[model samples]
Target: MTVSRVTLLLGLLLPLSAHAAEFDGAALGAVWALPFAGMLLSIALWPLIAPHVWHMHYGKITAVWALAFLLPFAGRFGLATAGAGVVHALLAEYLPFIILLTALYTVAGGIVIRGNLHGSPRTNTTLLAIGTALASVMGTTGASMLMIRPLLRANDNRRHRTHVVVFFIFLVSNVGGSLTPLGDPPLFLGFLQGVGFFWTAEHLWAKTVFMSVALLAIFYAIDRYWYAKEDLLPVDPTPDTPAFGVDGRGNIALMLAISGCVLMSGLWQPGIAWDVFGTKVALPQLARDLALLAIAGASLQFTPRALHAANQFSWAPLKEVAKLFLGIFATIIPVIAMLRAGADGPFAAVVDLVTSPTGEPLPAMYFWATGVLSAFLDNAPTYLVFFNLAGGDAQHLMTALAPVLVGISAGSVFMGAMTYIGNAPNLMVATIALNAGVKMPAFFGYLAWSCAVLLPLFAVVTWVWMR
Candidate 1:
């Protein structure tokens, strides 16, 4: 929002766009994907291998990758083409995505849940369930920010509680957000791309419910086993208060207002759009973005400072997301164009993998392809790639090819639990746990837990639903 920040955003993002030039993916080779590949690899590997360096210089690291793509792209295609792509990605995709997230984070961070409950197996399960349901409403980032501290406080007395945080990531951070755009970034990208606001809830609710219930049951059983092990601290770190309640409850109404803005944008298009660098910025989208910023400002103005202190609220997570995704949205421009090219593009093998020999689409393969990629890469752009690959027609995807959309949506949202880097909140929750003195697992250790638990369940989902 500051001038320097705007300059930095434009400086990094300027390489991705081309003025009025629709990129032909069939003309591009696989080498164009390296910057994107490097960006993702840095995100996945850096924190694990060099935590201090990553923490200190992640913005510089992202800038390096963005330049890596943009410099070459400008030289090869001319500056105008590169410039247009940057504006398009920024105004069309990045601004809206980051604005909504900022609003959600700001508003949710204002609401502070007070007091703590004992972390019994039943109590922990109930808390996870509540957080899971809230994920679809407040967003994984917002819901995770609101709920994790209370959950951690509840289990501060339990000596063996790493599994508690792990299951929280599985349910509240990933799987539970499948039913709505507010629940996850991938679904939100789908919404911005003309997918109906309610389409995901209608199609993916069954899967969401099935996954939520099963994960809750599994969490209860595991938590009970851990509870029975008699791992208890002699003195509870956080004593239970006589009263339990919420502060800054007014944000609840603001959250609904935010949801209304999104829903209205989808339903009430005025067909008036301004052409900015060849991208059509519609009036509805413009109004929605402005309203979100205003709502975020209102939260900051009215929410009490005491509530913020109680929540341990900070803007670091939101800032990190904005910076990292700046590089991601920039470098991903070509990969998306190539995927859009289908069989004629360099990623023809990808096309073949998701389609059958007879040219029939296979939802099971789509599920696995999107899931596997999402598990390693950032799920939002990964969702965009596959959504575009599936013909980039929201109406058609929601109707005739509904099963394929289901596969892509479920995979991106659900299997993000497969790794810490798969979704933003997974790492945020881990960091919060670590700060609270819970010895959260290293990246691979968490991966082992997810594979043991979620992969098998996903296999069953494929057989019963996707197939």
Candidate 2:
């Protein structure tokens, strides 16, 4: 790693020495969550109501939300305490989250699938099915980035292109990532917390398959309806061309390397870790992240410029994720801490809703609670909240409390499709689609799509699997 790399890594993994204090969640009121709520609302509304302002000043807007929480937090607690909370959030939560996402985004951006099949209903569904299969192997973002351009190009000639991107976000970016920890951050956090590597695959395979098939079927039906209503443009935007094959296949090895690195981190616990402030940074985890960064860099260096050019690879998508998530991480500290505090915290009613009076776990409620929250908040942290709510014991969660785990896991991963901000890839996919000239829905419009389509399907999911 170069000096710049080291500096960047250190900035992310900032030592918690100066601010080792913890937040007093019990003392904190519900008001503390305002900044987080504001951040999410801004993300949801600004693009629809004020696209120019959002596009230009989103980072500034994010900072405003972060400060809303931070300034008050520092005043109520000491600056050290507030700063410590921030550091811990960065170290334990955001750092690994963003690093791995960045690596995946970067590596996947280098690989391009070249081909333009006519955007027939069958062809689109087949592409979605293929992307769905690839999601668990390469991640939702990876699969979406790799396949979205072609899917878009295949359908560029058609009208009513918005629904295709919407379904694409639902299947390729969210539901398809349910089967493996590598597929989504929540599952990866589960793996790091001692859930087995194949645990998610073994448990969520049925749910993943059910959702994928149902969504594909629904998409086909809807797409066929749209295909029938298709109005041709004066000039066809994308003329059907000769068959195209996979280009930059070399990045496949790099993605596998990243996956292997994650598995190794989970399995190879050598008891080596650094005490960065109050947090213990483990060697295997650190090694995995470093290896991922190197792998991403290598993929970029080795891939031909022509391939990247073809893919229209740019840092804007990653930059959007990085900026927006910083505000989320900062502002969410209080909300998550309050949730962690459970009964005494302001969200006691929320906690009450998820459990029975007899203190037994309610799998159905857990599903909706986790899923609903994940739809608005980042799913990974939302998963962590409910994981702890369900007793955070990996061994028991894997065995006796299995249903609850499945509920939390399913809700967090599956419901990330309800809106663009629900998952990292959702926003990224929407952004890419918009850049590609698909008139993607605004936040509430997208929610209308999910609410109309996904909620009924999730009811079936709850009845079949979670219930």
State each candidate's clash count.
8, 0
Alpha-carbon lDDT of model 1: 0.91
Candidate 2 structure, TM-score to reference? 0.90
Q: lDDT by residue for model 2 over 336-430, one digit each (tens)?
A: 77877888889888889998899778899999999998998678768987887776789999999999999999999999999888888898788
Query: Which regions in candidate 2 have their CA more than 4 angstroms from the true location?
Result: 1-19, 228-236, 239-243
Q: For each candidate in turn, give its C-alpha RMSD to the true structure in angstroms.
A: 2.1, 3.3
User: Model 1 — TM-score against the truth?
Assistant: 0.97
Backbone clash pairs for candidate 1 read 16-85, 17-82, 17-84, 17-85, 17-86, 18-81, 18-84, 18-85
Worst 10 residues of 1 by lDDT: 12-21
| Candidate closest to the true structure, highest lDDT | 1
lDDT (0 to 1) per candidate: 0.91, 0.84
Instruction: Give candidate 1's total backbone clashes.
Output: 8
